[model samples]
Target: DKMKNKLNKQPYNTVLRREYNNLRNRITTLTRAARDDYYSEEFEINKNKPYKLWKLLNEAACRSNKKQNKEFPIEKWIDEKGKKMCTKDIANKLNNFFVNVGSELANKTQSRNPRAPTTRQRDSMFLCPITEKEVMEICKTLKINTASGIDNISASTIKNN
Candidate 1:
């Protein structure tokens, strides 16, 4: 009779305890499910990994704090292929390729401005000396030409003479 009376009085407390337990269980289940999903997604993403060969090449070229060898692992790749290639070789190839392409670009640029000369060439061709006597001499030497605004003669041209 006492047990039945206690149970009747505390029926609300019992229901509250049961609800708390159910919520806790649901939370644990959800947490586990989320963790599992995360790991599975990570696995799938990493399963067929995209090869970052260039990045690897760069990394291999870089020196590590632990090692003495400065050579990159790309050297091994070259070796494996039975092709004896060094960093200098690769660099030379790239330089030659760029030079060839650059010449083509320069040709196009030249077509656009045929009169444009390099700074050294332009200075050599157009620059005049700073002396009035030299200019007078040059003007006098060229009997056919009359000095209108010609003030100077290039020192180099005088030296050549």
Candidate 2:
């Protein structure tokens, strides 16, 4: 197939990687710029650029991952209640099941081995505050290109900053 051939071809793959990187760089620049100049008309244009680039990147990834076979549909799923569920219902049922199981496991573990009582002697002198150097070291040790945190800051950004 054309897709398979493209993946195999070194020149094509090089070009593809370059384009993907360029898009990512442009998107990141636009995003930071838009945040600073939120009220500007250019912000409107900047906002949409990332989404468009993301869409193309996602499509390319999907295409790269695809095989010759067509995607198959899930017929149905049976929940713990022995009731047949559709595709939409399956996710919620599985989530609830896993959550309940996790709680049960936690309770069982806690009952089996309880925590020891804390000693009266405190060692506050031994516990020193973390330094800026240590903080930077910790950030540098983190694996890059991972998903952003709840604050929407990436590990690379934190490490670099």
Tens digit of per-residue lDDT, candidate 1, span 56-114 = 43444563346677666655535446897887877787688887997788777745556
Off by over 4 Å in 2: 1-76, 79-84, 110-113, 119-161
Error in Å for residue 105 of model 2: 1.0
Index of the highest-TM-score prediction: 2
Instruction: Provide the global lDDT of candidate 2 against the true structure.
Output: 0.70
lDDT winner among the candidates?
A: 2
Q: Which 10 successive residues of model 1 have the least lDDT summed?
A: 50-59
lDDT of 2 by residue, 1-161 (tens): 44335556755577776766677688889987875564354445656788655555555455453456564434546667887778778677678889899788877775557779877757555667999999888988988879998999898888888
Query: lDDT of each model, Cα atoms only?
Result: 0.63, 0.70
RMSD of candidates 1 onward, in order: 29.0, 17.6
Query: Could you tell me how far off, in angstroms, the CA of residue 93 lies in candidate 2 after the best superposition?
Result: 0.6
